[model samples]
Target: MIRSIIKNQECFSIVQGLPEPGQDHNLVWLEVHTPTVEEGTILQQRFGIETAKKNSNVVEDGQFLYMRSRLLALDDNGAPHFGGVTFALGEQLVAIICDDANFQSFDIALQRLRRKPANGQSPKAIMRSLLQIANDRADELVDQIAEELEKRAEDISEISDGYNANGMELGVPDLIETMRALNAKEELIALCIETQLSLARTVRYLSSEIDSTNEADLQGLVNELAFDVAGVKEHAYFEHQKVQYLQKSVTNILNIKQNQIVKVFTIITAVFLPPTLVGTFYGMNFAVMPELSWEHGFVYSMGLTLSAAVLPLIYIKRKGWLR
Candidate 1:
């Protein structure tokens, strides 16, 4: 879908369809929402663009995606799932291509722009608003991630305390699953940071090339956007780091729990090994072995085997190995 925001004397005049040929080209913003290949072709022709921009990852007929004469750059757009925003600055117009029809960022940035009369619906202002919206959204996500991490951390503490108080046995399955979740969350935030980085780069790259009638005003907006997005990226990095710390802590706890279990089993085996040896020796003392044939030998062998087991337990207790 194509929409035209014609620059009125005071406010923007929003139209539903594409601008007609020889239409009001002076001070207009054209936004394309989820344009098809045919629409892209038409727009390319109308705007005098020789080629359209393609994502670097997109390849067809063994040809890698390269920069087009009109295309500036495309941001990373895989895990984001949401359509990526593409900016194409032409000689006579600035085109924004995106997939989502319900663009929350567009609405927010436009509202902010509307508040300042000095900043009407110019293409440069619209682009700035778009970037601002992205930064704001990213900031909100950071807060949400922080809150979630806090709650999860508390839950982990509770789980640890409970296990320690009960039987000194940690639930390996539950901890392992939670660890996996934290790892996935880390990956998601890292992707957001990457997207923000790409966005900031795109803005800075276009900072010099934006051919606006008002370059001085646009330059400041571009610089401000770069700064804001950088902050968002940093916060995202911090959140990811916290998640990593939590994951590592859980892993260490898991290792300690496993080691404790192994140590207990080792002590039990040690306490029983001597008794097992005694029993085997007495069983072999039959007719050929005089102890087994003698009347008192059976009682003697039983007492000796019991003593052997008790001696190991006493030694282990003295050494505090049983503890």
Candidate 2:
């Protein structure tokens, strides 16, 4: 499953093969993309590359250790040039490996390289080119994330306003979920920033040893990465503000609703108090109750009850409480 791209003398070519290491071919690039150590070993055998034997055997700090080495030297401009070998004999690689999201971009670049015949490019040059392409792909991903964030912020703002207008209640769970989503998006933006920063640093390192043509291409890729990082940061800030504002709005709405409930309870109590007092007085069943002996007592009591109820209603109305 190893995919190797070799650019020799301005020509780009790709080779898909198993991993094997011992040949001294100046233009050979070996990449291993196997899921298991056993599979990687088989690939290594097929390619004749030296596999880390004991270096791949032991566990270190509760995890398997994969030993990797790269050559470092000073370039003509006195800048450090790093070119290396990578071995994934460890659990970290296994655990961290994911389905490559950028595989489509890689495939497209490889197809372009294949269509144009390689004149005489070296393997190192080809690797640099591939790295540049990968950096560009990362930038594209960042841009896509930024766009999504912007759209989400807009949608959420609209939803918040609609909820406010409808007098609908948003529960704690809904608010919490919204906050969680915002936090996740913020984390992703941070990750994109980190990724672009790493690529930019690599570009600086590669520019020293890589030829002028590739260097210019890599620099352009670096600039794009920088721009992507900046955009992501800006969008992240906007999203943060939007999320904060929405949360505050929800809090205010909940508070208003609480106050409304209290006011309703108060009005109901005030309206019923007078009727309750009259009912209590009549309920005192004394045999000598003077009102009970009167022929017009029932009408008088009814009038009294009506007056008690109506007076509060009129007063509350005048004070605007009913509104």
lDDT of 1: 0.65
Candidate 2 residues 1-323, lDDT tens each?
Answer: 45654444555455654322432242344454323567556644553343343343222333322223222223344232233333222211111111221223234445544664441233333444444455555445455555665665554554545453456655445545655666765565455445444444444443444455755654454455445545544554555465455546656655655676789999888888999999899999777888888999999999998899899989999999876
TM-score of every model versus the real structure: 0.75, 0.53
| Sequence-dependent TM-score of model 1 | 0.75
Report residue 143 deviation for candidate 1 (angstroms): 2.3
Say which candidate scores most in TM-score: 1
**Ten contiguous residues with the weakest lDDT in model 2:** 89-98
On a 0 to 100 scale, what is the lDDT of residue 168 in model 1? 63
